[model samples]
Target: MRRALAVLEQVRDHAAAEGLSLTELADTLGLSKSTVLRLAQPLLDTGLLSRDRRHGHFRLGPGALALGQAYLAGIDLRTAAAEEAHRLMREAGGTVHLCVPDAPHIVYIDKVENETAVRMASRIGSRAPMYCTAVGKAMLAWLPEDVFAQVVDAGLPTVTTRTLTDPGLLRTELARIRNRGYSVDDRENEPEVRCVAAPIFDHNDVVVGALSVSGLTSRVTAARVRELGPAVAAAALRVSRTLGATR
Candidate 1:
């Protein structure tokens, strides 16, 4: 494991610095050029690694993009959860989102909004603060301890009157999310917007992202949140399992 990751990391880091040819890279890694060539072949096929203009020098390739798409398609946790999100939307008439924490912020990778044709402020590729939304909270609950510490070190920026800016309180909130298996955004990220999010775990039982449903604060009242929470959580759990998460 160490050797494989090490080689991938080294190739990525060194490619830009040394601009090595196959022979030079093999010499640098203390491997035969043929071995290096063979090792690089798979990534080359996947476009994660590529050869230089001469096909002798190596560089990261477009195949990496293919792998990214493949990873998303193969492990398509968000896509799987999207169905549940859409179902929730259909059942309750709102917008749903699938997001992953990118630290400092979260990015929506998929969504299913109502059919009303009204323009929404969020969708796939949109970014939101981790300290504000339900998806952010869901994603944050599973963040590595050291990363959480870093988030705590950086003062949380308040986006609205409902935003949780205190690190201590936010930490407490995260704890509750872990226990409850879901999160809520009560007009925190944006005034008048309420969101509910559930964590989606991967095969390793690690949170890879969150599934959320959002609507006008008036629409997702406290009572309505309670009503829809279980459905949303179940959907997220189902998607997690489809992604190979067992727990």
Candidate 2:
């Protein structure tokens, strides 16, 4: 089972490269073609992988997406915020994302795409640095200082020209987020993309995750960001309430 799972992860990694041929997968894993086929057969039966008849290529199937959805549904944070995330996408006229802190990074767990012609590049399970993104900063602002320090100690990568690699400046930005009850990403992660996000808390008033609304700067102006700030905060607070957070 463990070996099968390891191969499964490898298969997922190869999905963006237009799936993987059986020979390609075997070569990549340093395993025999027979061994690869044996492992892939059970996954194919379970609908975890789909194969092309002519090309003999394997790719992630609908069952994999179902597994992801099931996992998300089982999480209280994602369950509580799912509707709000969708509603915010409609209300704010942009993409909505729910993210959780993964140490020095933030991982997007769910996203509601914008309906307009313009859209963001982010997808579910995508990751971003803790220092630049609105969702990252929103969670960072409420995290314990020691934990926040640990994140900074892990090396902040320069993502873009606007990314704040300076710890002092980043802290100052987080402080403002704490004061205002929300965070904003002004093309720090992606050029011409701006985002507004608010942190979500648990029953213990511990920050566990965040929700964000993002769009192209041409559509989401500074004034629009200010307008969406409170809206996003309110929506996130509602999700927090569902999770038993009082404050």
Candidate 3:
């Protein structure tokens, strides 16, 4: 079992870069070429790894991606937030999004649209800039300082006139978000859209994701936005509790 796991690990790294030759894999694992081939055969047959007949190189196959997708689909956060997102939409009269940080971006994993006249552009798999969305800012406000610095150093693009392009100013906003227990995007991502969001914590007290209520700025005005902030935060907290969060 240990040998099989080691072979998979070596192949996983090589598959992302230049695929490893059988002999190279043997050398990397300190095993004989025949032993490496023998260990890899089962993986190849199971579709976890694939070998090139033309170049004699080995890489990950479709089965690996299938397993990854399956794992992501089984994450508790998505299930925990599903009903809460619907509840938020019913109460707030806007679209509700459940998103997770993907480095400098936030990816929506679930959504519930208001049954009224409001409509939002986001879909289940849509992504948005982390610096310009309320869901992104909610998660970012809780990230460790070093990690937050890394994201800011990469670059913050201006999506609209209200977007915060300066790192110093963004930090100030994040601090306020941390204090308020939620974040707000005042037409930062789009000229006519606005959102309020709060972070969801995991059992480890780590911020695993965010939940946001979004709508057209005309309907979700400044006064209404303020009223929605605490509601969003409370809904997010409910999801955190369902995920076994203690913090």
| Separate clash counts for every candidate | 6, 0, 0
Q: List the candidate numbers ranked by lDDT, top first.
A: 2, 3, 1
| Candidate 2 residue lDDT tens string, 1-247 | 8767767888798877878988888889899989988988889999898998888888998889798667545668888998999899989889999999997899999988877747678878888888889999999999988878888899877888989888999999999999999999999999889999999998678999999999889989999999999999999999988776779
What's the CA RMSD for each of the models? 11.6, 17.0, 12.3
Which regions of candidate 1 deviate over 4 angstroms? 1-73, 117-119
Question: What TM-score would each prediction reach against the true structure?
Answer: 0.68, 0.69, 0.69
User: Which TM-score value belongs to model 1?
Assistant: 0.68
Model 1 per-residue lDDT tens digits across residues 78-195: 5577667778778878888888888878898987878773445996897878878898888889878876876667668888988899888999999998898899998988888888
Error of 1 at 220 (Å): 0.7
Model 2 residue 56 CA deviation (Å) reads 76
lDDT score for candidate 1 against the true structure: 0.79
